[model samples]
Target: MSNTNSLTEHDHPSVLLPLLYESAGHLLSSAGALTGEQLRAASLLPGWTRAHVLVHLARGADSRVRLLTAARGGADLPQYPDESTREEEIRQGALRDADALRMDLETSLSGLLQAIGSHPDEAWDVPVRWLGGGRRPVRGVLWSLLRELEVHHVDLAASYTPADWPAAFTDRELRATVARLREDPAMPPVRISADGGTSDLSTSDRPGPLVRGAAAAILAWLTGRSDGAALTVDPPGALLPRVPAWRR
Candidate 1:
């Protein structure tokens, strides 16, 4: 879905918050169902295991809480700790038995939901700096957070596939990812196909390439999980390299 399809200001805070909460809850439940060995299984992310992904999820929730706190006029939130530090924290915290991990995830998720639920509707208008440049309304930021959880939940590749992704999730996330890639100079021009239609995207400010496939497939390929092999590309050589990292 493109920005045009994004939730309007009036619908953002009220509608998106519960969606994000539910998505997070689903992810935690899925992670909790994994056995210790399963949790340790390798994921698509280079060397990270399922445990590492879960750790990132937990930390990410904490970070969102901090961001929301800052937007509410609390003191400056601390910068995210370095990757190695975070990885180690996840290694220690998420290596517990399945039940323990579930408990921990539930606790963290509860805190996040409570933080969001406590805010007055007016708080949605406050500006918050997103991970990317520029500030967006708190509602937009919250929606972005929901997008993060849904996208990464699939990245875990344990229970869901790109095709299985929620329609609302796919629409919002694909549009954001494509728009961001189109803006970055480091990436190349590429055509994205979704829902049997094609969207040509270019690195330049002008129009993008036109390619044809499912929207979820385009999202998967762009994120480095699926190669463009599944879609048709004109001048086949024009496709760009996959993104080096998924958005944090």
Candidate 2:
């Protein structure tokens, strides 16, 4: 479950980290409720089991640790040797025993947190570049990690859903997504609004699709959490326009 915090324009990651830990703790407890068979059951991610989801979550932390460390020490290191190797590692870890999986997840999370804590206050704002190539402040890694945990927690398909998302996170993520969509060459020019005319999510001048809904519903649809089932689209129940994989 997510915290009930709201986002402010000046919110800081330092203040958000503990609440993210609480959210992760909640995710772990939910995972704990599953039996071994359930752990191996297929998740909402096509071809991935719940075990795969858990292991991916764990591996994500490890990858982040590598990035955080490089940011702190100003060293050059790859987040993973390669994407193929990363996938293989997840596959191998997913086959672990339930207890081993849990232990691995715990270990990964703690290790990354320690890495984050190792940074000097000034180091946190230093730019870190991913092996695949994009740079952002070290503190940005924390937000990405939190997004990974919270989003994949839903992907496990055990009991969580978008409704469990924190409003602040949803709002922030949704705004960021809209910014991306505006620049996306593939995304059709359209107008998007939520909450009865209070929100404008699109910057396009072209008159195309008009998607209107509650904030969470629009976020869920944009992020591939749903198929736009409950949203009101122009042309009436129109299918959601295709978009690239989310940039999370």
Candidate topping TM-score: 2
In candidate 1, what are the lDDT values of residues 35-127, reduced to their tens digit? Answer: 888877887677777777777777767766776787788545532445566567777876677677666777777787788888766676666
The lowest-lDDT stretch of 10 consecutive residues in candidate 2 is 1-10
* Poorly placed runs, candidate 2 (over 4 Å): 1-11, 196-198, 235-237
- What lDDT score goes with residue 24 in model 1? 80
**Full-model lDDT for every candidate:** 0.67, 0.76
Model 1 — which ten-residue stretch has the worst lDDT? 1-10
Model 1 off-target regions past 4 Å? 1-7, 79-85, 127-141, 196-209, 235-244
Model 2, range 3-110, lDDT digits (tens) per residue?
Answer: 113333334556677857777887888788878899999988887899999999888888888877888788876677777888899999999889899888888888
Task: Give the TM-score (vs. native) of candidate 2.
Answer: 0.88
lDDT score for residue 24 of model 2: 82
